[model samples]
Target: MDFCWSPTDPVIALFVPTDADEMQPARVSLIHVPNKEELKKKNLNGVRDCKMFWQSNGEYLAVLFNQFNGTRSTNYQRFAIFGIKDPGIPLEDFELENENDMIIAFSWEPKGQRFAVIHALDQRQNVSFYSVIKSHNRFQFSKLVTLEVEQAGSLHWSPAGRFILVAAMRGCGGDLIFYDVDALATLAIERFVATNIEWSPTGRYVATIRTLSDELDVRQEEFQEGVMIWSFFGVLLYQIPRRHFTQFWWRPRPSPSSCTQEMQDVLEVVNELDIDLDNDLDNVIFFGDVDNEDTSFHIIYRATFHLESTRGLGSVVDRDWTYDE
Candidate 1:
């Protein structure tokens, strides 16, 4: 065992890095939160490595493991899914049939119905998708796509099982490949692509971090910041400036275009409402660039609202002076 938990599974996780036999066997384990009694089993997957395991569903315990198929890891660099359910009890897995090495990187579907895996094939990249069948107790290998030397890169499935976004960095700069999973074989490609992609929570937008450096003139390092907000159909909505690492809304509710009147006629009135908890004059807002060099500076946008004390100013004074009503 090249890996063991430092404290316990409760504190830090333990990894084997490589199996005793395969050295690195594309390992993955799921600790499906089980009943307190059922959680104590150590040999369910022919391994007692996990601190606790539970059933993600009625039939599966989600696992994360360190196993390499001898393709990527010096010790164990590959990860996989193992079903810790019935008959075989432990190590009972739905292995990738007729494959030498398991894919180095993979992602599970949001709904947990499917997962996507890309593997090493013929000195090339091949992406394979697996659909989870709960009733049948198996993972159905559904779709497969193969690519050349540098094609099959930056592949990500949408949050739902709608489509997959892939970037192929082959001959030219690169390409964004969109494959509609529902349409079947309908592929759309966007030229000049980059990586580190994220689809918006609403599933309408995609964000990717890309370096805009020159490929040939690598020494001419002209680094700038940018963020591209793209639509589902690959339209450039806007490439916002990355000032202070700005964030763009990937998916906003679709609405009619904004008009000039739609912009709020922001009414700002500044008056001293002297209920001064901490010199409530501080609550008085100045709208313009009224920079007081002594105490205040501009960039104070506006004062919207304030809370007032119920006590009258005269009574709150608590002084010896008497006033006639």
Candidate 2:
């Protein structure tokens, strides 16, 4: 089990299993990080494995749990939504179709109240989409779409929450299926046997790194590592082979304030000015004579002003241009 923290709040959700008593059921704990106070603890009787997910807007928290049925001997996939302001009351509790269905994959939208779940049922897998809704001061979950996939690996949502990537690793020789969330239709598919796939921070690109052997399994003896970077629209950006390639990461883009076109142009001008100033200062030092004993001395004063456009303030820089008799 893993813990998930709210994106815009100080709340976290985690699952705690029973220690020794067979009568005691597992509990999911919602805690406040700053004060370490548990806001709510909900009992899960037959939950074996679970995951915590928070909505990007920080309005709701979802807990996906796999419940074990000891009588019929099967797994049940269920999800529960809790209100952030009132953790004690559950907003919604939904169970997938068929109690024997197994939760193969699940993911939440990166920036919205929508989520997707893939489960195995009736000898095939189905993908279901659900979104949170509010009705008369209460929250409700509405099913958006349910599509069928042949063989799915994992679920990944785009940073912009516009598309979903369904990775197929085992059956189809490693393929990625992209789906449009708004249209609820298939967009594109790319076949690549990748051990890991990561989305760029800015949601512009995704990198798939090869770390597995031809059998689609990770092993130490496997060589001939490779990587493929692709755009969000399924365009192949770059591909290369590397030796002993363990990991690769995209540089996180700076905030909008530091990445605007105007800011970039200003930075370029400042860099050029700095280079020119350095050259001019070097020439001045080489031409100035320190050994001359002249009663009358000439002093050159140079001032560079730094303007903070956002704050409307200016500061001066001293470049060691003072001379005395």
Candidate 3:
């Protein structure tokens, strides 16, 4: 079973796969939260797996189904779009021109009317873009463009939209491509053995992470575990090597108006100190207070003296201080 919540509405979508032994068909349902009502329910046959995607505005929901051909022993893909806000919650079914092509990745453009899919056939992969168009009070899906990509298996869209990062990860050789949707141009192409890709909340930076597992052989050079930070245009900003690195997360930032006075004061002090934690170690001078009783008083005195020294009243204070009791 899998479920997803609508970003902008009080709706939740649920999917339960069919059980061959129990003789049950796959099911999908949308539930309205506040009123505890069932909005829509759909049953499907021959489905092996289902994935659900909600548009940024919660206006529509896309369901991708992977189905198997029992006779051919092959798998194919189909997708359905549901107009959540429309009357009766209408749904439209769609499939690729080649039914045998398997979809490897899918993404909805942030706050936009389009989505992209990476589909593969016999090892050759291509990324296709589609737009959801509304005409005559009905919604339609239109294919925009399809581009052949080298081992591309995943898509990461910028938070603010317009840019996308196409990457080939794990067994796919770790190739990276940054593309501009509006200009139909490739911004930068690079390589990294990334197992995961993330875009900064502000859409200004991207982080390609390579995490290693014990089950995989780590003797290969490409299996190095670390994180690489890149600019929106794929410029390499910083690369930090971490042993056994498994996870990465971005810190959330609050708006300027939400800043408290204490927070602003801390920022001012940090800026004034101008400490370079990574490179200023050589200039650090340590003052140690060994007596337990006078430690606090000495710390205050030393801090005051250090601040005065910065103004030419005494010698310059070191960036570090040590206290012992």
Candidate 4:
């Protein structure tokens, strides 16, 4: 097995990179979380090594594999989709159907049912989209559209699920491609080969770290070893140079946006009450008196007034103090 994890579900999806047979069909195993028992083992459509991906929502899992016929010199690719709820069954399984095309890379839109694939046809690569649908209580997958792109690498969707970045890795000599899902428009910036891509949690910025390869020219080599931050609209925001830089990551944001207004109001009221109680304690005065007895200190009365409260609630504490010296 190459990799395995629970992408958001209780069941674990394990990807076996290759099969025992000479056909080398990629296999995936779905195991139950409670007993660690294998629920289903599925053989994919294509024969060569495969890559596994899961949608962020965990509703769908996709496997992309390459196929080659002995009579043909070109490579062929296909993808299979499995539903998490029905691990034993495939939701959608088929080849690309596009003539002489191979799927290079694909990515799921974060928290969404839509996904994009980078496919190569006639030695040209482009972007294509697919969406999950339900009708008559049966789930189905449908192709939406395709966009022309010069080359393909990896695809990354923003945390907000609004934007996607197409990374052209080292030696591809392709620029960064940014796509806006709602608008169905793409923007490309020239002269960049990204080794790694990271999206800010707020979806405000994208970080692309330059990849160093033997194909880089002297001019490209001079500026190709740094981190560049770009806005979602494909504008160059900033870049930091470091030849040895390897990775870039953004921290996960908190859930403050999901907090309701009423919740915020209640939190504010509680905070105010806490501050009022603290202030009242600070104002409390401590007084002690020595009694006629050999060893005794007496507190005749103690009062605490909550000045911050509108009702001005006050309490009195009284006790006799006696201690052996």
* lDDT (0 to 1) per candidate: 0.41, 0.65, 0.74, 0.64
Please, what is the TM-score per model?
0.50, 0.70, 0.74, 0.67
lDDT tens digits, residues 112-217, model 1?
4556555665566666666655444544344444433245554676665567776643223456766665554545667644435767655565665444444422
**CA error at residue 47 for candidate 3, angstroms:** 2.5
Candidate 4 regions with alpha-carbon error over 4 angstroms: 15-27, 44-48, 67-75, 86-90, 187-189, 211-224, 242-247, 251-325
lDDT of 3 by residue, 140-248 (tens): 8888778888778788999888899999876547569898887778899886567788787777788888788544433556576767878889898776566666665
Cα lDDT tens digits, model 4, 1-325, are 6655657767777776654555666677878788888766777544557777887777777877676676548667767677776534545675665857767788889889898888786768788887778655456777777877776678889888868887677655676788888777776545677767877766777788765656554365455575777878789866656555545444343477876776576446546444453233322221112121222112213212222222343333332221211
Our model 1 lands, by Cα RMSD against the true structure, at 14.2
- Candidate 1 accuracy as lDDT: 0.41
Which runs in model 2 stand beyond 4 Å of their true positions? 1-4, 34-36, 69-72, 85-89, 170-172, 213-224, 256-266, 269-325
Error of 1 at 52 (Å): 14
Candidate 2, run of 10 with poorest lDDT: 299-308
Span of ten consecutive residues with least summed lDDT in model 1 = 264-273
Native-referenced Cα lDDT, model 3: 0.74
Best candidate per lDDT, number? 3
Q: Count the backbone clashes (under 3 Å) in each candidate.
A: 23, 0, 0, 0
Cα TM-score of candidate 4: 0.67
Itemize residue pairs with steric clashes in candidate 4: none
Task: State the lDDT of candidate 2 residue by residue for 1-325, as single tens digits.
Answer: 5678888888888888755654788888888888999887788888766887777777777788877777737667788778776534456687775667887777879868788988886778888888878765577778988888766768878787878788875324445787888887887787556767778665656777776455555454533465676767777866656555556554344676667776575446546444343222212211222233332122111112211211222222242211111
- Candidate 2 has an lDDT of 0.65
